[model samples]
Every structure is written in C-alpha cells, then in structure tokens.
Target: MPERKPRADALRNRESVLAAADALFARCDSPESVTMADIAAAAGVGKATLFRGFGDRTGLIHALFEMRLAPIRLAAEEGPPPLGPATPPHRRIPALLDAVLCFKIDNRHLALALEGTGGGSPYAAEHYERWHSTLQEALEHLPGPADSAFTAHALLAATRADLVEHLLGQQRMTRDQLRSDLKAYTARVLGSPASVD
Candidate 1:
C-alpha cells in the first residue's frame, strides 16, 4: 500500500490536473492539442507528476471519462424520477433531451476526442443504454405506436456532438433555435401533438 501522505498528495495533484484539463479543453475545443505539459503547467505541477498520475495520454483520457462521465451515469440511473403514468410525456421528453444536450455542451471537447478514436469505452455504452432506457420509458407514456427502441436510437443519433458542433460552429444556429427544433422533431417523431398545458 502507498503511504497515506503521498497518496493524498497524488490524489490532489490528479484532481488539479483533471480540473485544469477539463476547463482548457472546454474552452479550446480540442483536447488533443492540450498536451501533458500543458495540463501539468495548467495544474501547477511538474510534467513528471502528470505522467505519474496518468501513465499516458490514453490513460489520461480514461481517467477523464471516469472522473467526469461516471457521475452523469450514476445520476441518470438514480437521481431522476423514472417516467411513469403520473409523469406527463411532453415535459418528460423535453427534460430528457435537455439533459442530454447539457451533457454534450459541458463535455464537448472530451466527447469529441473520444469519438475521434474508433475504440469504444464502457462509459459511452452505459450512457447510450441509460439514454435509451430513459427515453423508451418516456415514449411509453406517450400515445404512440412508434418502435420505442428505434425511436430512442434515432433521437440520440440526431443529438450527437458532431451535429451540435456543426449547427453551432458552422451553421451558426442560435441555441434557442436548436432547442426549439429539437423539441419539435422529438414531438413529431413520437407522433405526439405539441402540448398546450
């Protein structure tokens, strides 16, 4: 076992590095360009310490997912109230999309980096499954005969980071416009009329 003092210091250093990387990556739009030296400098640590904390770039990426995405997975699992007969489908549907959109916005760079590589992570899979399950449950509440599984897949595919980047960065769609269009598309795909309530 490692000494408590050294372990504690290592943990603190790791947190600092990750926090700096997350912020820088979010701002810069390209995590790959942010090197270990950049992260170490940002964290006020030596590059050696950064390397020690995470063995290599891939390890750092894995750690990022663990530190960032894990909580989202847990929250989506246990934090939100499950969709049921009592919950209105329109509200729940928009809420689900909003949660996903917020996540993409927050984790934009990390998500883009992860997608650039073909390898899939377990956390990504868990996210997709959670999204599909939550959406499927919400769709069940709606008055429709659409295949819930396919609909969930389509919804997620349409809301990917690449699409968001294109819409915001290239197409220059305003946030309000994106949200409005997403809501309309979701309602139409589910075969549900817009709610006035």
Candidate 2:
C-alpha cells in the first residue's frame, strides 16, 4: 500500500490552529496564560487535534514565530540596502539590530510568548544561529579587536524579546527612544561613535 498524506481537512485544521494560537497569544498578557485547550476551543478543534498538529505548546509557538519571521528573513537575505548583503557591514549591522528591535516592539506579546520559558533558550534556536552567523561574519570585517563571535552574541543579546519587553513595559521607554539608544549603543560597540544617527 502507498503511504497516505494527511487529509486536506487536517491541513486546514493545522492552519486554523496556528491562527487561533496567534490571536490568543497576541491578546494574552503572558504566553503561559494561553493554553492549548484555549487555542483548540478558539479553532473549533479537539485537544487531540491540536496536540497531533503541533506536538505541544512550545512546538506551536515555534511554528507561529517562524511564520511571522518569514518575511523579515527574506528581507534580510535579499531585500534592498541596509538589510541586504549589498550593504556595507558597518551600516548593515545597525540596520539589522534596528529591524530586530522593531520586530520585537511590533509583536511584543507574540515575541514574549515565543521567547518565554516554555519556548526555551533563544540561543538554542536555529533562527538565532542564522542571525548570529550573519552578525558574526559582518563583525569580522570591522577594524576593531572585538571577538566577532562574542560581539555578535552580545549585539543580538541587546535585542532579546524579554529585555525589550522590560524596557518598553516596566521602564516605559518609547519606541523611538529605544531605537535611538540601541543605535547609539551599537555604534559604541563598533567603535564608530559618529554612526549613532
């Protein structure tokens, strides 16, 4: 007998589940508050279906985050200046960090949920490796004595979703203020004091 692919209805259910989860995460104060049962209810699917589709809450959050990040990934890989490979490392680094900060700001709840304890260490994620590798390679081209690898890690760390949430929520830092601070801080790290514009 031939292997059977999942039914069309199953595929539809999976997408619906992910969409429902996204909505729930967006509205909730914390990712922990959005339970699988809540998502299953929202999607009109059974708990079993939700688990079968995503394995667990963490898996579901990871999938949703990947979907949201797809466009940004594409832009970074091939879009115009500041983000694309065609841009110089000095400029590209700040652009990349700024993009990351903006993304986190725009998707605070989802970003928070995805980076939450259930989602595990961001450092362990594949996307983190890609971002780190890109930044590390860029740092290598700079004239500083900074360890490219370590510097990349430190740079990315500055944009961690939890830290962003703390700054925005608890610290009450406005978006522009946060962006300027990050740009200035990134410039200092790169030994380019004049690039803080």
Candidate 3:
C-alpha cells in the first residue's frame, strides 16, 4: 500500500518543533536541560504533538541531528571533489573527516546531546554508524592491507563530540589548530598525500 503524505500543517509543526528545539539547545548550557515540554512550548504546540511526531526525546534529537547533517551527507553522497565519491581515496578520506570534524565543531552542543543519547557509547548511535561506514568504505579504496574497519573507527574517535567539546570548550584549542592536528593524524594513518606535512 502506498503511504499517505503527512498533512501540510503536520509538516509545518514538525519544522517548527525542530527549529525551536535547535534554538533551545544552542542557547542552553546543557542539552539534557532542553525538554520536550520546552520544545513544545517554544514551537507553540502541545507536548502531545511532539510525542506523536517524534516518539520521544531521543527520537527528536536524532531527527534534528540528521536534518542539520543533511547538507554534509548530500555533499559526500553526490557533490563534487574532495568530498564526493569520485575523489581519490586519500584526499576524500581526509576531506570527509575534516567535514565531520568541522560539523561537530560548529554544532558541538547539539552533537554532544545527540551523542549522549547513544547509551553512553557514541559508537552505538546511528549517526556514528553512518559516518563509520562512509569512512570505512573510503579507507578501503587506498592501496595496502590496512584494516579499514578498525582504521575508520580510530580516525573517527578523534572527532567524537565529547572530545571536540573538551578541546574547544575547556582546553581552548583553536578551530584551525584542531583541524590541522586531525589532518596530520589522518595523513600518517593513510600514508596518503596529507602525510607529506
């Protein structure tokens, strides 16, 4: 059976909820502090609407995270060089990591909130799994016998939200400095062109 599209108002309410939730998370000191009631109040909808649309707090967070990550994912899936599949593995590998790192850096708070929902292990999250699979696929394209799965996990570990937050929030590392460090680390692992530095 064909699925029915959501009503226009329902869709609008969903967008409203996402935007409201995003603002609250961005402005709040902590992600957990932002609740469904807050989101519903901000969106001008009832808590029931939020629960009906998103199932729960975690689901809503995941949806919002995916929405924010759409642009980056689209670039990797179909966009141009350095991020798209057509690019060479070595270059693409680092580019993807750079993108993920930048995204987490840019949206650290929200990312941390989403990561926190992954049962205390960020690796268990669907978002993390998608990145892991993407990086692992890119890693496999390089020449050599490196274990792509392990290598991908190791590389991704450098960009986890908690670490990024600690480095940028508490450790006071500059954005450029963190990116440079990640680039260098990735280069050494892939023995790719970035390793020349």
lDDT values, one for every candidate = 0.71, 0.87, 0.91
In candidate 1, what are the lDDT values of residues 80-160, reduced to their tens digit?
Answer: 543233446667766577667766766777766655543553235445666778778877776684687787778877678
Relative to the unseen true structure, what is the C-alpha lDDT of residue 189 in candidate 2, on a scale of 0 to 100?
A: 91
CA lDDT of 21 in candidate 2?
89
| lDDT of candidate 2 over 1-197, digit per residue (tens) | 99999999999998999899888988888867899999999999999998888898878888888898888788888888889878888899999999989988988887777767443677877678888998888888889836999999999999998999899999999999999999998988998873544
Alpha-carbon RMSD to native, per candidate: 3.9, 2.2, 1.6
TM for candidate 1 is 0.75
Q: Which 10-residue window in model 1 sums to the lowest lDDT?
A: 78-87
User: What would the TM-scores of all predictions be?
Assistant: 0.75, 0.91, 0.95
User: Cα RMSD (Å) between model 3 and the true structure?
Assistant: 1.6
lDDT tens readout by residue for model 3, 9-116: 999999999999999998988888898999999999999999999999999999999999999999998999989989988888889999999999988889999999
Clashing pairs in 1: none
Predicted structure 2: clash tally: 0
Candidate 1: lDDT over CA atoms?
A: 0.71
Residue 192 error, candidate 2, Å: 1.5
Candidate 3 at 22: error in angstroms? 0.9
